[model samples]
Target chain A: MDMQPIVRVRKLNAWFGAAHAVKNVSLEVEPHSVTAIIGPSGCGKSTFIRCLNRLHEEVPDARAHGEVFLGDTNIYGEGIDPVVIRRKIGMVFQKPNPFPAASVFDNVAAGLKLAGIRKKALLMERVERSLRHAALWDEVKAKLGSPGMSLSGGQLQRLCIARALAVEPSVLLMDEPTSALDPIATKKIEELIVNLRKEVTIIIVTHNMQQAARISDRTAFLLLGELIEFGATSEIFTVPKEKQTEAYITGKFG
Target chain B: MITFSEIAAQGYTKRKFKNRLMCLLFFVAALVALTPLFSIMGYVFIKGVGSINWSFLTQLPAPVGESGGGMANALVGTCVLIVLASIIGMTSGLATGIYLSEYGRGKLATIIRFSADMLSSVPSIVIGLFVYILIVRPMQSFSALAGGVALGVIMIPTIARSAEELLKLVPASVREAGLALGLPRWKVTIWIVLKGSLSGIITGVMLAIARVAGETAPLLFTALGNRFWSWNLTQPIGSLPVQIFTYSISPFEEWHRQAWAGALVLVLLVFSINLGARFVFRPQISRD
Candidate 1:
């Protein structure tokens, strides 16, 4: 692990009213590296990532108490704007949700447009770059004027990826990005995620264990809102330290 | 025992007969529902279309003993009242909807939601009487402004609730997606949430407008029915419903015919509005 990780978490805790959703856990994600968080349902993988960018606060009874540092700045610090933090750490959701009101081109351009980027040529270039980055440009380039909803599920997911990347965020949080997609689409997205690591740091939460081994430089195993294991992918997969981790990896129980 | 094929064939025949009977019954029910509307439209067209000339449309109402006058003032008055009322109605209704759906929570939201439901269910005449007390008595004179205020007030709760419901139909995921991109809350609500529900919201607006347009009870006490052409908002103005009411009640036969003509025009106006609303908002449904 690098001494100065791009994202560092310390004693992170979250609750949905009385239900503790994310337990006290700490982790660090190095820059331009893929860190996969793998877990079963209700394991707080989504909640943990959402906390990274303050998206978890949108829930009615959801609350987080933790110190999350983006570089040297404590993201959860006083006077730190969550909106600014969100801009810096773009998030893709479990479900592909592109704006139905916006066209394919407009959907990618939406983030930039919201950030007050008015230069038409710059928007065009960035939109193109982002789409290319998500590996969706060639398929959707001809019909960019069509509504984003008109695209296939995979294409829409890729469109969402492009939308997130358009803002040029330093970190990207994806919560089960390919869970809703078919195997072929999932493969495409997996490839895109691998490629995207060269530009932006990525933290992907996926249920597929093979996916973790395939893409992640390092992997964290979360269970019942607690971090059970965090280590290099090869070491964790071949030689497990925790019995629970081994059981989960071997499909003894989820 | 009968063979299996024979039994199956007999059952098929019975089912086909039942299906045809059900289809015929439904057709009859539809005809029964539509008969009154068609007859009323047919009667009005036969009687009123003759009365609806350029002069009848563009001229003032004929006096009690006079002829050759038009509902020109009434037409313009109705338009003005509707235009003013819609502006007042839709703006507040939209705002209320946004609050109710997005910001309204706790006891206040409950009170507001309850208030909206109760207000919409209030009888239009009761609303008229209430408006009379609120505006007409205070103003000391019947004004077009007061009439518009009544209609506008009547529309607010219905529009508010429907728009709120439509806005709620917008998936939370879409809203989350936009906010995740760092868009402001207002932008997420207005540009994304409201825009996504635009067609449905417009449908609500249209339904509310249609509801308020044909109402005579509210306008009876407020606008108070003008006899002459008047544009000033402070003065009483003629409206189609009120004109139809007055003309239909009088002993004068020609006035009765003119009233029928006015009813025809009003029906067409509202019907077309509803029809146009469907067409305008259809693309929204298809997109969804």
Candidate 2:
């Protein structure tokens, strides 16, 4: 609890053309902890996480005017590469996006291969390790040669997680990774996330309140592009300071 | 008076009858649409396939009144022309397509896109005349190079627009996934976005090639046809389409038969290219 934060944001704002999406949001994520971002739909929770890796600016009209620090370095400083920044902060999407044309082994090894790791032995080792970390090794080991898209939805999601993990990133950002999953699959991913928290700082944007409460140590509530409250997960649930937060948590209104 | 149920049943029967009648009408319309196409194929196969043999493929056109001959020079020239044109076309087309789909914005992309669409609709004969004045006249000769350049010019707009549309089908998420891996934007575009739509791009390329295979108007002015086997690209060259036009209009019946044989070869060449492309893409299509 006393550890220094691995990621910090100060007055971060995102704009999609003329429309402001994330306005002056700031938070800190300590290493080896899971911080859940909770919000209703269209609340900029997804946009906020996207900014952490500088991915929000991919759209031609989308721009970010804010400071995000990974470790001690500001990611948007002059000559700082977004590609390099993203390498340290890996991301998993809401819907599973395993490379359709690649094999299961190649999908897990995609990021590593891009980084120029061509040695077969080294690739095999890393792929196996990443798959194990994502808790998908045993299930997919025999089928490593199969096309990545041939897997079930849950397995594809896990393969994506495995792909993200292969690069050995410092922070893992997930945007509602389990929203597309069935209950049993969601439970499995939740369990995997809990197990994964020991090695990296995890920040997850989830609309499911129970999921946030179950998996996160800290929770940040966002509404209409504003961060309304941030607190320890237990206290946020028990003694919410904002009425809007209380209303949202109690299901009185989204 | 009829009961309410009986009235409802009569209405249902009337609607059902209409539906059946409409289905029959659609079938008849479909047959009408397809009959001409099949008849053309049937007629061409019957008339042309007989003249196609090994010697007809390998031998040069018989001297004036002789019986045995082949479009050997034309076949080879068509290949050289198409290959040259494709090389020129694919380079410009793919580069322009990449710019149109991924890079350019504002007024420039719109202008280029509009111009490409307009160029594709221009008549091939007009394009041939334009090529004749611009290239063949300047070069001071009707050469295979000029002919290839003409076809290449025609290929650019079609291939570019097709490539652009196909590249656009690549999901934004795929770009994000590639960029997230720390690869540069251009590398992600070439390796991921372009690779993802490669099959579609190839389909476009094949279609463009096929269209040029049957075009005679462009070659009439640019290549100007040769009587002998000539490999010199800077000199006049024989091409199948031009040969077909020349022989079909000739006074001799034997030349007409040779033209039919040449037409058969051209059709088979195009058909095989399309079939070969489909064969190559089967594994790609099997993927989810």
Candidate 3:
């Protein structure tokens, strides 16, 4: 509690037309730590994470009102570009989406290359480091020249993680990164998340209770677009203060 | 329990007969659809092959009563007109399509899309007349530049519509992934989404090129069919389709033979273009 939090969200509200998706969510995430958001489907877990990087508003009818502070700067302040904010706070989606037209190596270098970084030496160095950090360097090092979409399903998800990490963001948001993976792939990604916490702060959204318990230092339970409970992962799993949190964690209801 | 014999008695034979009859109908319909394609190709080859000699391809057209000549001037003119049209058509068409699919979501887009659809259905002859009034009258002369602009107008609507459809096929997640990487929306639309659908767009362009290559009506008013060898864009130019049209209508027997040869060459040019497009822009190795 003594160390200053890296990310602080206050009075966050999101809507898709008239449907309010994320309602007044407030939380603080410690630097270089993992925070998991567990909830049932349509409970705003994904929307809450998206709002941190202003990605929630990308949808056609979507809008948000909130203050999200990233290292003392409110990202929603006037004249602040969402493009710049996104570079500082990276995101990984539920499905593994690697650029279909680019090679594995190029996919990892897309963010920098598109931002006008053209030196081959710089791109190669950053791509290698990101791949290593995502723990996919050994599996894909030989096939770096092949199309990114040619990778196996599990490997593609890790490749996506590497793509996100290549930009060197301070905070990483993962929206159901393991939902589309098989059991073994899911386990590997969970391990990767634990390892990644040492380099960057992480906020992960998952419906899997066991995953939140196994990898998170802190947990937030969201239900019907509201924050139901927030606490240390061990206590929330063992002795949740709220009855709804207990019912959800114990599998009585989603 | 009902036995297998009980099931068979329940109109099984009648249902099987109906299925066979429908399959036969579909097969016959397919054959009917293919008849015109094969017949035209076969007829063109049979009548046109004897007229095709090396000299017929290299030498300029001889005077009307003469026997020895070629369509070399027409070939080069066709090439010039195509190059001009491609520049104009591809640039504007691709831009319009990108705008329509990516940023066009209001009344203006609807009006543009509707206008494009109407323009595509307009007859090529009417397009020629419109260009005749717009350019030919103002310039007071038929020139390759005017002809090229006419063909280019015919190409725009086709390319724009196809580009829109092909770009729309790119999955939304792919675009979202680009945005999440901190790339601006325009960069994501152009470098990522547009680049991915490039092969499909090229295929569409090639088809439009082939269609315009065989067009005679638009060039009739603008190019006006030069008999002599010429390369100047401001002067009258000879094109394959126009040359074919002119020679086919003449009373001379020699010109008829040359007309058949020109038709064959034009058909072959279009066929090879289509074949080349497939070879050059084959889709990248994509799993999904």
- Model 2 residue pairs with clashes: none
Candidate 2 residue A37 C-alpha distance from true site, Å = 0.4
**Top of the candidates by TM-score:** 1
Every model's DockQ, to 2 decimals? Answer: 0.61, 0.56, 0.70
Q: Which stretches of candidate 3 lie over 4 Å from their true place?
A: B1-21, B280-288
Quote the positional error of residue A27 for candidate 2 in Å. Answer: 1.4
The weakest ten consecutive residues by lDDT in model 1 chain B span B279-288
All-Cα superposition RMSD per candidate: 1.7, 2.1, 2.0
lDDT of 2 by residue, B1-288 (tens): 999999999999999999999999999999999999889878778889888899888888988888888899899989989998899889999999999998979999999999999999999889899989998999899999888888988999999999999888776777788777777888778867887678778888888888887888999989999988888888999999999889999998888988998988898899988886676554442222
Q: lDDT tens string, model 1, B109-182?
A: 99999999999999999988988999899989999999999999998998999989988877888888888888
> Runs in model 1 with CA error above 4 Å?
A1-3, B1-6, B283-288
Q: Which candidate order results from sorting by TM-score in descending order?
A: 1, 3, 2
What would the TM-scores of all predictions be? 0.96, 0.95, 0.96
Listing candidates in order, what is each one's chain A TM-score?
0.98, 0.99, 0.98
Better of 1 and 3 by DockQ: 3
lDDT of all predictions, in order shown?
0.91, 0.89, 0.92
Q: Using TM-score as the measure, name the better of candidate 2 and candidate 3.
A: 3
DockQ of 1: 0.61
Q: C-alpha displacement of B219 in model 3, angstroms? A: 1.1
- Comparing candidate 1 with candidate 3, which one achieves the higher lDDT? 3
